[model samples]
Every structure is written in C-alpha cells, then in structure tokens.
Target: MSERKRFYLTTAIDYPNSRPHIGTAFEKIGADVQARYRRMEGYDVFFLMGNDENTVKVARRATELGLATKAYCDEMAQQFQDVWRALDISYDYFIQTSDPRHHEGCRKFMQLVYDRGYIYAGTYRGWYCEGCESFKTETEIKEAGGVCPVHRTPPVERSEPCYYFALSRFQPALLDYYERHPDFIQPEPRRNEVISLVQSGLQDVNITRIGQDWGIRVPFDERFTIYVWFDALLNYITGIGYGWDEERFREWWPADIHFIGKDITRFHCALWPAMLLAAGLPLPRRVFAHGWVYIKNEQTGAVEKISKSLGNVVEPMEIITKFSSEAFRYYFMRECPFPGDGEFSWSRFAEVYNADLANNLGNLYSRVITLILRHFEGHLAGSRAWEPGEIYEEQDLEATVQQVQGYIENCEYQLALQRIWQYILDPANRYADRKEPWKLVKQDLEAAARVLFDLVESLRVTAILLKPFLPRTAERIYRSFNFSRDWQQVRCEDCYVYPRPVDDLRCLVRPGPDGKLAPLFPRIEIR
Candidate 1:
C-alpha cells in the first residue's frame, strides 16, 4: 500500500470578545469543508482551530462581566467550542493562546528570532485600535476621523517601551517570495493587495508591550508581555506540539494552508512570513483570505457587518436549531462566493434552503425511490441486468467529478458546489421530469425500471460527491438506499454499483402502497 498523504490546515484563531455569530461561523465551516475534502481524498488531515485569548478585548469583556481574565477566557473558549461543535467542525486540535504550551511555543519562537539579532528593545508611540489589536498608520486612521475604520471608534494613543521584530529587513525577501510563489496568497486580489503593501515599504513591528499583565510574558524580559498578534500567531504551530514534541511538530510543520478572513491578510501574509523567516522556519504553503459576511437588516433594508455592538448578530445555533445542520451548511457553501463578500438574509436563507435542498435535491431523492417501488415491486436490478441507455448517458459523471475537483483545488468552493448541483442533481431532477418514470411504468415495466435505475445511480453519485459538503445527509441517503454506512469506504467509483433490496434496510419505505417517505429537507413556512 502507498503511504497516506499528510495535510495540515488552520483557521485564524478567533478573538473571544463575545459568543460566535454567523460571521465567525463562516470561517470555521469553510475550513471544515476543506478538511473533510482532504480526508475524503485519503489524506492524513490535521486541522487546527483556536481562540486568541490574549487580546485586550477579552480583558475588557472580562472586566465588564466582573470576572477574572482567565475565568472569562475559559467561559468564552467553551462558547466558541460549542459553536464549532454545533456546526460540525472536525478540527483535530483547538489551541488557546493562554495555554501554557502555547506560551512556551511563542517564547521559544521569540528567543529564536532574538538570538538571530532580529529582535531588539524599542519604544512604540502610536495610535492603537483595541478592536483590531494593531496599530493603525495615519493614512489608515485618516478616513475614519482619527478612529479605527472597522470599529468606527477613536483609537487610544499610547507610548510604551517594547521589543521590536526586524520586519523592515524582510521587505525585499517578502516581495521576492510573492513573485516567486504567485499563489502564496489566494484570490489574486488579496495577492495584489499584499504586493502593493510590501512595495510601499515595511517597518519593524513591536513584539511585546510593557504594561499588559493578561498576556504571555516575554521569555527573557519578564517585565513585558508578548503582543497579542505575536503570541496568537504561534498557536498554529503550538497546537501541533511545536515546543514539546519535535517529532509531531516536524511531521506537520509548514502547514498546507492557512484560512483567514480578508481583513487580516496583511498580518498573515506579510508579518507572519517575516517572523517565520527570522526563526529559520518554513512558511505555510498558502494563505487564503476569505471575504466577510454581511447580514441584510430587515428594518433598515441595508447590509451591515454581523456584530453584537450593532445589535445585528445572527445566532448560529438558532439557525442550526431552526434548520437542520445540513441546510445551514449547504446554504452558506452555495450562496457565498468563496473569495468575495456574501450576504445573509433570513428571506434568502429560507428561499435557498427550500429551493435547493427541499425542492431540488430532496424532491429528486424522494421521486427516484418512489418510482422504483411503483415500477419494480420495490426491487432494483443489478448493474449487469440493467443495460446502459440514453437518460443516464448524458450525465457525464466522470467529467462532473473532474470539474468539481478542479474547482475545489482552486478554493472555489461556491463554484464547485454550483457545478455539482448543475451537472448532477439538477440534471437528475430534469431527467425524472422528462422521462416521467411513473408514466413509463404503465406502458413498459422494463423501460420504466431502467429510468428508475438511472435516477438511483445519479443519486448514488451525488451522495458520494456530497459526502464532504453534507456528511450527515450523505450517510442518511447512502443508508436509505441500503448502501454500507462505513463512510470511509464511500468512493466515487461505488456510485457505479447497482444495489438491490437488503434485509437490513427493508424498514425504509418504497414508493407504492404502504410505502413511507422521509423528506431530506422539510420545507419551512415563514411566519
């Protein structure tokens, strides 16, 4: 047997300022899809997600709640975990910046750069955005009236003694790296943005703050604490056992991909590479900066960021509970363009959920099995008995699989799903309508059986393709048709196998008299 390929992936650790909303859930869900896809392709996938707990926002939130910083972080960590669990995120490890191992890893990284003369003592006097946890240059602050543009609030001006990393030394190297590896940052637009920023010039970055007591303390200088970004960025490596387990760290070092939001691309693509270069570490292969999620407010009829402060945050759990997790996952994956901003509206969500999941896919599955019982006494003929014919020949299963795979490789998740639905599911539904399998049965049983078999084959292929995107639903469909429930054994080629009635699956209904039916996605009625 050949060796199983290894894949390492991570999402930007979230700052636990509040409970997760739909916006934050988007990143976790997107990363989860990628991890699932890699696993389906038989890779040894390690997906790391985490909470950035060293932020001043967490400290402030804790103070407001009259809780200790650690206590607050612990609570917030659980909240984040709850959201990820509810969303069915399959991350291998979830690291917290406040973890002792993470602190050790960050200190070790700092020491490595310091030993190389890439870090030095310095004083920083600048305008800081507490919300962003980064200093904003005058040019950035100007458009927002001396405030942080995203938060729409004035920054706190501070002067402090700090330790600085020699980021200025890596401008030429970073530009060259970007040129040599054009795909280092994804979505072309993000790469262009990073290139422009680097061409402007780079400056040394402050690595530690003197007055923060709630963050990781510097290894050498105990008086200062590590900056949030400096400490938080290391969690990606720390989660994989960077400080304590060299063997494990080396196994997955040089992550295959880093999935982050667009707002922070500069930090991940620019400063992160410089830090790794200083420490003589290999850089992550790719950084994909996905766009933000906007919610269309019903009252104002205007789109806005999904934020608690704006009183417009949509609770992810509420949606997950209202609709099945499959519907939740499908809507986001289908509606949102992976590389661009996506709008979320209850009306739109309901429409897409009903149209795609309930009406299209669910109806297709129900109709196929229903027709099978109506025509063939609840029995499906094996592939050997069913000769190939026209209704199925036009689907082109191989080309559809190749097209979806190519789109996935390019990180075009929306496009990948769109193509699958268009080429496979939609075509199956249309074939059912065009063939009128119910009508065919009265005139000719064999011809009708062939049509039902064609539809069943299409569904099997779709289930295999849908495994990574909608795992639970895929398993349900597979088992409903008497296929093995062992998902790991589910391969694209299996779709070609014709299945007959199995004793264990007899409890599932057929389409004729006394035949019961279950809707994959039940239609929702809006109040």
Candidate 2:
C-alpha cells in the first residue's frame, strides 16, 4: 500500500484571559469540520488546538483573585476545555504554553535561531498595548484616537532591555516566497494586506521582555521572559513533539493550514513565517484569516463588537441549551459565510432554527416515518415498482456530491450547506408534495410504495451528507429508520444507487413497534 498523505492542521490557541465567547468557538467549529472532512477522505490527519497561558495578563488576573499565576491558569484551562468539550471539538492534542514540554521546545527553537545569527540583544523603547501584548506603531495609535485599536485603551510607553529577532533580514526572502506561492494567504484580500505591509519595510521585533517574571525565562538570560507572541506561536510546533521527538516531528512538522481570526493576520502571516525561516524550518502551507462574529446592539440597533465592556457578550451555552448543539452548529455553518464577517441577532437565530431545523429537516423526517407507519401498517413490500429509476436520474445526485466536496475543499461551508438545504432538502420535500403518498395509497398501492421508497432513500443519503455538520441529529435520523444493523459506518455512497438488500421495505426503514416516533425538533414559540 502507498503511504497515507499526512495532513496537520491547527487553530490559534486561546489566550484564556477570559471565558471564550461564540466568536472564539466559531474558529474551533470551522476547523473541526475541515478535520472531519479530511478524515473521511482518508488522509492521516492531526488536529491541534490549545490555550496561551504564559502572559502577564494571567498574573494580573491571578492577583485580582488572590491566587498564584499557575493556579489561576490551571483553573482557567479547565474552563476553556469545558467549552471545547461542549462543542464536541475533535482536537487530537491540546497544548498549554505553560507545559514543561512546550517551555523546553520553545527555548530550544529560540536558541536555534539565535545561534543562526538572527537574534541579538538590544534596548528598545516603544508604546506597548497591554491588551494586545505588542508594541503599536504611531500610525496605529493615532488612528484609534491615541488608544489601542482593539481595546480602546491608551498604551503605556516603556523603555526596557530586550532581545530582538532580525525579521528585517527576511524581507527579500518573504517577498520572494509570496511571489512564488501567491496562495500562501487565503481570500486574496488578506494576501494583499500582508504583501503591502512587508513591501513597506520589515523591522526587527522584540522577542524577549525585560523585568517581567510571569512567563518562560529566556534560555540564555534568566532575568527576561519570552514575549507572549513569540511564546504562543511556538505552541503550534511544540505541541506536536517538535523538540523531543524528531521521528514524530518529521512526520508532521509543516502544518497544512493554520486557521486564525482576522485580527491576528499580521502575526501569523508575517512574524510567524519569518521566525520559521530564521530557524531553517519550513513555512506552513497556508494561513487562513477568518472574519469575526459581530452582534447587534439591542438599544441602538447598530452592529457592535462582542465584548465584556459593551455587555454584548453572548453566552454560547445559553443558546446551545435552548436550541440543541446540533442546531447551534447548523445555524453558524449555514448562516455565516466564511469569507466575510457574520452578524448575530437573537431574532435571526430563532428564525433560522425554526425554519431550517424544525420546519425543513425535522418535518421531512417526521412526515416520511409517520406515513409509512399509518398507511402501510409498518410493512413496506419492496417491489420493482419501488425503484426510483427516472426520479434518481433527474435529481443528478452524483453532481451534488461533487458540489459539496468542492465547497468544503475551498472552505466555503455556507455555500455547501446552502446547496444541501436548497437543492437536496427542498426538492425531496417537493417530490413528496407532488406524489401525495398518503393519497396515492388508496389510488394505486404500488405507486404509493415507490414514492415512499424514493423519499426514504433520499433521506438516507441526506443523513450521510449531514454527518460532519450535525452529527447527533444525523445519527438520530439514521437510527429512526432502524437500519442501524445494516450500515455500521457513516459515509456517502453514489446518490442514485441504494445500498442493497432492498428486497423489503422493512429491511430499509423498520417502523417503530408502536407505529410512532418521537419528534426530531419540536417547534419553539418565539415570544
């Protein structure tokens, strides 16, 4: 057998300074879907996610709570894990920057660059934004009215002894890399932004901070701590056994993709790649910067960023509880376009949940099962008449499989779902309406059997297609048919061809013993 193609993917680790919001969860969910799809396609995949705990912010928060920094991080790490667990994120490993392995790996990686003559000691003075944990340019400060663009807080001016990375040395090399691989950064617009910034000129960046004791001690100088960005970026490789396990590291060193929020594009696209080049390591194949989740301000009727100060923070768990996790996943995937920012409103969310899940998907399943039990007395006698020869041919099911695959490959999740919902689900429902299987049973028994058979098989294919998106709901629909004994795996087969042993309807869709099945998603009344 040929070697399995290796694929390593990651999402930017969370800061763990606060409870994660829906915006944070959005990146995780998107990455998880991509990972699931790759696994289905038979790639050897490793997905990594983690938390960034080596920050002065953690120490500050600890002081407020009268706890040690490590103690606070331990507690906060659990909180972050709880959110990931709730979302059913399928990450292979979760790396904490505070981990001993990570510290050793980061120090080793830094030393490799230093020995290469890419790092040097220097004294630096600049305006530092504590919220961002980076020095801001004068232009950036002025644009935000003398405050940090993201936090709206004034930066503190500080002069300190530091170690700087010679990122300036890689200016030509970076431009050349971009020229050779135009697709390094996604969405074209982000690529243009990174290119423009690099072309303007490159500057050496401060890699170690002075008089800060809350983080990993610089290897050569114990008095200083590694800067948060430098430390956090190392987790991507260190989590995969980079420093210690050469054999394993070689297996998946160059990540296939790094998914991050748009705000951090500068670091991931420019700084991180330059650091890797300095270490004589391969750059990650791609960096995708996804947009934020903007929520509406209730009183002003204006869109606003979701933040603590605005009190516009949405509690993801509250929404997940009210609407199941399946609905939550479907809403975000279907409603949010991946390339652009997504808007969130309680009214829009409720509207989508009721219309798509409860009305479209839930109603279709309930109607199909209910009619089979009522008219056929839980027995479907499979005959040649039931074969969906022309109907299947008309649906062009093969093309749909290709369409969905293409959309996923390009990370166009919303488009893929829209095709499934509009083309697949809507057409199947309309077929039911045209045949009127309930009425057809009295007019022509064989004709009615054919209609129900087509509907049942269509649903089977839909459940398979839906697995990576709404896993729980898909399995529930699958089990309702009682064919759990037939197919042990969740996979997509040729749309027109049914998985065989189709001699009996009872074999395909076994009706519940009581001729009744529970509702999939009960309609919720919007107050």
Candidate 3:
C-alpha cells in the first residue's frame, strides 16, 4: 500500500471585534473546499480555524456596547460559530484565543523566545491605534489627524516600556528560508511582495504592550499584555494541542498551508514566520493571500469596496437564505480565481445560477430521471452487448473521467464541473433531438435501451464528480438512483456492473405551469 499523504491547513483566525461578513466567510469556504478535496483524494487532512479575541478592538467595541470585554467577545465568538455552521464549514479545530490552553501556550512560547534572548523590555514611541491594537509607522498612518483608517477614529501617541521581539535577528534566516522554499508564499505576486519587503529591511517588533488589559498578559510581566497579533497568531499551534499533547502536536504541526486575506499578508508571511523561527518551530509550508470581493452598483455599474461603515456588507446568511448554501458556495468559488478580486453583482449571480444550476444541471438530471422511469417501467435496463464497432461511448467516458481527475487535482473546480456537465449536455441534446424513447419503442427497443443506459451512466458520473462541490445535490441524484453511499466509491466504469432500474422519479427543480418558470435568481436588494 502507498504511504498516506498528510495535509494540515488553516484559515486565518478572524478577529471577534465585529460580526463576520462575506470576506471572512469566503476565506473559510475556500479553505474548507480545499481541505475536503484533499480528504477525498485520500490524504490525512487537518483543517484549523478559530477566533482572534485578544485585541483592544474587542475591548473598545465591548466598551461601546456597555458590556464587559469577555462577555462581548463570547457573544461575538458564538456568532462566528453560527456562521461557520450555516456555511457547512468542516474545520477540525475551531480555536479561541481566550481559551486557557491558548493562554498557556502563548506564555510558554513567549518565555521560550525570551529565554533565547530574542525578547527585551524597552520604551518605544509610535503612533498607536487602540482600536487596532497595534502600532503604526508614519507612512502606515493614513489620516492627517492621526485617525485609524479602519476604525475612522483618532489614535493617541503612546510611549511605554514593553517587551520587544528582535524580529531583525531572523531577517537573514527568513531570507534563507524563502530562498530554499520558493513557493512558501504563494500566487507569485504575494511571494514577490514578501521578498521585496524582506529585502528592504527588518525592524524589531514590539511583542507586548503596556496599559492593555484586554489581552493575554505577558509572561512574567503582568504590567504588559501581549500584543494582539502576537497573541492571536499562536492560535494555530494552540489549537493543535501544542504545549499539551506532544503526539498530537507532532502530528499536525507545521501546517501545510495558511490561507489568509491580502490585507493581513504582512502579518502571516512576515511577522508570524519570524516568530516561529525564533521559537525553533517548523514554519508553515505556504501562505496564500487571496484578494477581496467588490460590490458593484446595479445601475451605475460602478464598483465599491465592501465595508461595514459604508453599510455595504453583504451577509452570507442573507445570500444563503435568498439562494442556497450550495449555490452561494458554488458562485463564490466559480465566479473568481483564488488569487484575484471578484465583483459580486446580483445580475451576474442570477445569470450564472439560472443558466448553470437551475437550467443546465438541474433540468438535465430531472429530464434524464423522468425519461428513465417512463421508458423502462420505472427501473434501469440491463446492459446490452456492444456492437462490434461500438467503442466511442467507452472511450468518451474514459476521457471525461481523466478530465475530472486533472481538473480537481489542479484546484480548477469550475473547469471540473464544466467537464462533467459537458458529458451530460451531449447526451441530453442527443436524447432531446433524436427522441430516442419515441423512436425506439416502435422501431427498435434495443437501440433505445442502449441510449437510456448510456444516459444513466452519464448521470451517475456527473453526480459522483459533483459530490465535493454540491454535496446535497449529489446526494439527491444518488438517491434518485437508489444508491446511498460515499461518492468516492462510485466510479463511471463501475456503473456498468449494476444493471439496475430507477423508479419513482421526481423533478429535481420542478418547473411551473405555462411551460415557463419565474426567474431563478432574484436581484439582491439590500435593506
């Protein structure tokens, strides 16, 4: 037997200061899809996700809401869990930075680095955003009045004695790591950005901040709380039983991929790795920084960034309610490549769903199943012997199966779905144009049986390939055929073995009267 491949993946822990929006949900869904795909491919996969609760942002938001910081964070963290469940995210571990285990892990790691002489206490002056819980350089500070850009609030100039990590000490080591692993930071553009930043220079980063009572207290220094980013980044290890379960830690440590948004690329790709190197831990294998979602105005066609302050945040629950969780997931992944920005338009979503899901995919399945029951007495027909010259059907199935394998392996899910649909479309068009059932009952029963048998096999193949993306739909398709089993075991070639019949066919998407249907995708009118 071949050795089992191992994959440990994670999405950036979301800050619990505010409720999550589509952007955060997108990252989780994307990472979840990849993890599921890996598991289907027979890999030992561990996917981690969690909340970043140790920040002044949470404290300030709690203060604004007139609640204690822990209470506010706890409430917000539940919201995160709700969204994840609604989205069907399958994370192996959902960590919270406020967990006692996390605090212990953070302290231990900090102490290890401190004992290694990488951390020192010093007074540093800088522009600070209590809302962001991090210091900003002159250039990083956007507002002329010293307001935090993200919060749109003024920041105070602060000076305090805090524990600082000698990030500069690992500059050469980081450069060497990058040199050895070219794909460590992914999508080529992000890797180049990291390289440029590392080549430019490095600075010692403040790992602890004084006068912040909302975060993990620094080891041996209760006067200073560990900085938000530093404390939050440790969740990756803390969630995997680091500093507790040595065997479990050894099993999933050094994550295979760290999926993060472009906005926080610097923290994950730059600072986090330096911290890991300092602690003598293996670094994450890759950091993939994905871009944002742009919401375009319906009438003007002008695009704007998604922001809560602008009241333009598109909630995933709202979309899932309007459409479906599967549709929402399919649209997001299929609409854009992983690394590029995608525009979310109501019109575009309607077009894709109506054309792809409602009409092409759903209609095709319904038609095939309906025809099978009508023509074969509500049962699948036996496989007839192929004529001496008939090899095209077998060859075509083989080629399409190969295409499915390649498309999924490359993470081109849209292309994979299209390839499967192409097989369905070809036979569907032939069945419609030829009217095989009508022609065969009178003229040739064997010929019509052959056509229907081929169609059934094609439907089975389509459902199997679609299991990863549209699991619910795939299950419906499988149930329509009286098979209830994992999709991985079902192969197109194996469909020939079971010469069974399917009865009691139902419309996957029932069409309305007048031989017409209402628009499958209604426009999104945000209230």
Candidate 4:
C-alpha cells in the first residue's frame, strides 16, 4: 500500500489584542472542517492555529490591562485556545509569535531575504494607520475621505527611515506565477481581484520600522523592528520550522491550504508569494480567502459587518455557553457559505437549531431508537443479516455520496450540508412521517422491523457525511449501533460500499431511567 499524503493547513493568525469574536471564529471553523475532512480522506494532516502577538496595538492593550506584554499575550492566547478547544478544533499545533522558536525562525527568514538582495535602506512618507499597523496608499485614504474605513479614524501622516522589501521587483514573476497557477488564489471573485491588482502595479513595501520593543527585530538592522505584516506572514513558515528544523520545514513548506480572511487576499496572493520567490522557497498550494460573518441588525433587519464601532461583536463563548458546541458548528457550516459572506442573529440561530437539529436530526434519532427499544428490546433478530443496498434500496445512494464528496472537496460546506439534508435526512424524516413505524408496530410487527432497519440505515449514512462538520454529533450517532465498520475507521467510501452485510444490527446506546435515548439537541427558545 502507498503512504498517506501529508496535508499542511493553516488559518490566519489572529491578533490577541482582544478575545476572539464570532467573525474571528468563522475562519477557524471553516479551516477546521477542511482539516477534519482531509484527515478522514486519509491525509497526514498538520493543522496549525495561533496568536499574532507582536503588534503596537497589542502592547497598548497590555499596558491598559496593567500587565507585562508577555503576560498579557500569554493570558489572551489561553483565552483564544479555550474557545477553539470548546468548539472541538482539532489543530495539531498552536504557535505564538512571541515564542522563542518563532523568534528564531523569523530572524533567520529576515536574514535570508536580506542576503538575497531584496532589502534596501529607505525612507517612507505615507499615511499610517496604527489600528491596521501598516501604511495606507493615498487612494485607500482618499476613497475613505481621509479616514481608515475599517477603524473610522484618520490615518496619521508619518515619515520615518526604514528598510524596504523589493516587492516591485517581483511584478513580472508574480504575474507569471498567477498565470501558471490560476488556482493558487481561491474563489473566482478573489482570484480576479488579485489579478487586477497585480496588473495595475506592484509597490516596494517598507519591511522595517524604527525601534519598537514589542516586535521582532530585523536581524542585520537591530535599530528597527520588522513591520507587523512582514512579521505576521512569517508565522506560516516559522510555525512549520522554516529555520529550526530543516527536515520538518521541507516536509511541510508548501502548505496545502492557507485559510485566511478575504480582507488580506492581496498580501497572501502577491506579497507572500514574492517573498517566497526571493528566498527560493515554494509557494503555498492555495490561499483560500474566506468571507466575513456579518451581524443581522435585529432592529433594522439589515446585515452589517460585525465591528467594535457597531457595538455588535458577539463572542464565540456566548454561543457555545448557551448552546452545545455541536449546535454552534452546525449553524455556521449550514447557514454560512464558507467562500462567501454570511449573516448571524439570535433569531436565525434558534430557527436553524430547531428546524435542522431538534426537529429533523434529533427527532429522527430519538424516534428510531425508542421504537426498537420499546417493542423489540433494542435488537434486530440474530438471524437477520442484510446488505446495505437492501436497506437503502430506494435512493441512488452512491450518486448522492459522490455529490457530497465533491461539494466538500471544493469547500462548499453550506451546500454540502444542505444537500445531505435535502437528499438524505429530509427523505428519512419524510419516510418516518409516512410509515408511522410507531403505529405499524401494532399491525405488523415483522414489517415494522423492516422500516426501523431502513431508518437506522439513514442514520448511518448521515453520521459519516456529518463527521467533518459536526464531529461529536456524528460519533454519537455512529456509535449508537453495532455496525461492521469502526467509528474512527469509517470514510466517505463506506457510505455506499461495505465489507459485509450488517450482522445482527443492535443499538449500543444505553437509555435513561425511562428507557429512552436522550435528545441529541433539545430545542432552544430564542427569548
């Protein structure tokens, strides 16, 4: 047998100036789903997540909190990891920019780029937005009426001596690279925006700023700190052992995917690749610029960007505390298109949770288990063993499974979930409604057992499909039955094809005192 392919994946490192909000959580969740899916597909996956601690804004926030910079960064990194763990993010490693390993790797990278002759001493005069921790182009400022549109504050005009990255020198190479690898920047709209920007022109960017104690310093120029973006983007390499571990670095250098927010597409697509080119390193396979999660204004019913100025920053913990992490995961992956923007509101969340989880999935699980336990003692006859096809005979099972696999491969998570519901869950729920297996138990006990078997088969198919999106919920469903395939060993192929007939299918779940499996998702009241 051949070896499994290594899949190195990462999400954009977030600033630890504040705790993570839902908008921040969205990108992580999207990346997590992909990582989980890849693992299920037999890839040796390395999922990396982290905090961007080296920033002016972070230092300022630390001072206001009356804590040392390192202490503040450490505390917030824990808080960030807490939410990720609570949501069941299966990241292989979490790297902090403030860590010694990262600092070492970052310095080595700076020196490599410098020695490659891409660095030059220069002076810059531009509009600098401290909130963004970067200089803004005049067009960007003018378009926003001289204010940073995101921060809603005027950018200060600043002039300082700094070191430059010869980004403009890489324009031809960048354009050629984009043309050769059209799939490098994902989601057609984002790819178009990046191509247009490269066609316009490339500008040499300032890679260093004078004397900041909180950030990584330029290796050759000790008097200056590396610019935050220049430092921040290096986390992708530093986390993977760019300088420290040669073997590990070579193994995972060209990331399978760099999942980032759409706001920073330009940097990842243009500047990041150029930096890699200068250092003679391979470019990441793909940079997927996933969209933002907006807030549905309850009063106005308009979806607006979740921002501090709007006073609508909803924390991930709030949702997790109120509902199960499974509910939080399902809602976002089902409602929000991963490649495009999605809106969130308490009302919408409740509606989806009730309709999808409680009514359809939860109700089906409870009804099927209760039927078997009540009339037949939770076991089908030991003599009964049948092929999976004999159970799910009505549907073109393989075709539907292939469709979902395709949707998932393309990162069309919302559509993938929708298709599973429409073709699989919805049909099962409707079958339950029409068959009324509870009522059939009275008429033909033998015939009713057949219906129960069919419904349970539906649950099996669903558990496999939902594994990546809702890991906990899927396992709960799969482990409830004594199936031929092990819960951990199952994959997309197992949905339609099986090794042998299901032998003496019996429920493995223990019931409560009342002799009933508990509801997976108890309905939530929005108020």
Over the stretch 1-527, how does candidate 1's per-residue lDDT look in tens digits?
Answer: 23689999999998888788887888888888889888887888999998999988899899999999999888888988988888889998888888888988888988888999999998999999877888888888997887899888899898889999999999999999999999899989999999999999998998888877799888889999998888888988889988877889998989999999999998999999999999999999999999888999877899988877787888889999888778878888889887899999988998998998999999988877777655565676544233334444534666668778777767788998998888888778888889898898889877777777667667777888888789898877776665544667765545544354422222145434455676789899766
TM-score of each: 0.94, 0.94, 0.87, 0.97
Once superposed on the true structure, which residue ranges of model 4 sit more than 4 Å away at CA? 383-395
Q: List where candidate 3 sits over 4 angstroms from the true fold.
A: 1-3, 142-155, 384-443, 482-527
* TM-score, cand. 4 vs. native: 0.97
Evaluate residue 468 in candidate 2 and report its C-alpha lDDT on the 0 to 100 scale.
Answer: 73
TM match of model 2 to true structure: 0.94
Against the true structure, whose TM-score is highest? Answer: 4
How many steric clashes between backbone atoms does each model show?
0, 0, 3, 0
Task: Name the best candidate (by lDDT).
Answer: 4
Q: What's model 1's lDDT at 334?
A: 89
Q: List the residue pairs that clash in candidate 4.
A: none
User: Model 3 Cα displacement at 155 (Å)?
Assistant: 4.3
Candidate 2 colliding pairs, count? 0
Which residue pairs collide, candidate 2? none
| Candidate 3 displacement at residue 442 in angstroms | 6.2
